[model samples]
Structures are given as structure tokens and as C-alpha cells.
Target: MIGVLVTFTQTDKFDRSTLAKIAGELRGPFEGMAGLRFKSFMLDEDGVQARNFYMWDDDEKGRSFFTEELVDKVTGIYGVPPKIEYLDIVGFVDNSGT
Candidate 1:
């Protein structure tokens, strides 16, 4: 498994309602994507940044997803270029159902 983190710096702060709407709008694009295990969208408390954390079955797929075109699309939506980082998944702990 691999973990891909893409962070976007914000040009302005968004209110809670606006942020929820943005997250809703962005969710459709990621549905049923190939090689994607799952994704979590996040925002900082100060609302100065947004991030997408993607878990991938393959590292190459994760790397390929962050193309120039994707960057352009994210910039178009958020008004800032994204910084992408890929990392190996050393371990995972999931106990949500417990």
C-alpha cells in the first residue's frame, strides 16, 4: 500500500458551510477511481489549507494521479497549486468499528 498526500494552500479562508459544499463537489470525482483504496479530505483549523489523503493499492497509480492536468484542475477549483507527496505505508491501524 501507499499513501499519497496532496496539500493546497488557501488564498482565503472558507466558512464551514462553504467548506462542506466544496468537499461535496470534490467527492464525485474520486468515486470508483482505479487503484484507489480510499481518500480522506481534510482542512486545517485555521482554514488556510486543504488536503487530500489517498490510500492506494499501488504506488505508481498514486504517482500518476498527480499530473499537471490534475494540478491545473485543483488550482482552478482552489486558486492554488497543490504540493503532492507520496509515502510508503509502513503500517495501519483501523479500529473504527470497535
Candidate 2:
């Protein structure tokens, strides 16, 4: 399994509502992606962040997902470009309501 995590933080001029619509637009294509195993998103007001956690079976597919089409799909919705930070996770847990 391969995991990719991304963090999006707004600039001094952006708002959360605007960011959320950009995120919502991504759900359909990402969920339908060939090698994507799991995808989840979350917002943290106190942290002032938006996070995405995705798992893919193939690394290439993961790396190539941010195509111009997807970028347009998101950037077109966003009021401004977001600052994105990519990541690799060493560990995690589902918690499963336990």
C-alpha cells in the first residue's frame, strides 16, 4: 500500500468556505481513480488546515493524479491558488470508533 498525505493552508486572503468547495469537487474523480484504495478529508479550524489522506496501490498513478484537468477542476473552483505540502506517512491508525 502506498500513502499520500497533503496539507492545504489558506493564505492571509483566503477563506475556508471557498477552500471547501475546491475540496468537494475532487471527491468524484478521486474516489473513482483506478489504484486509489482510500481517500479522506478533514478540516481543522484551530490548526487552520485542510488535510487529505489517500492510499493508492500504484505509485505512478498517485504521482500522476494532479493533472491539468484535475488542477483546473480545483483551481477553477478556488478563489485563489492554495499552498500545498505533500507528505509520506510512517504510521497511522483507523481508530474505528474504539
CA lDDT of each prediction against the hidden true structure: 0.85, 0.64
- Tell me the tens digit of each residue's lDDT in model 2 across 1-98: 56766555555534667556766776787667789878887667564666677776777777687667765654555433444434555566767779
Backbone clash pairs for candidate 2 read: none
Best by TM-score: 1
Model 2 Cα displacement at 19 (Å)? 6.3
Off by over 4 Å in 2: 12-26, 83-98
In terms of TM-score, how similar is model 1 to the real structure?
Answer: 0.86
lDDT of 1 at 28: 94
| Cα lDDT of model 1 by residue, 1-98, tens digit | 99988898866885667667888988997899999988998888888888889999898988888888988997887778889888999998878769
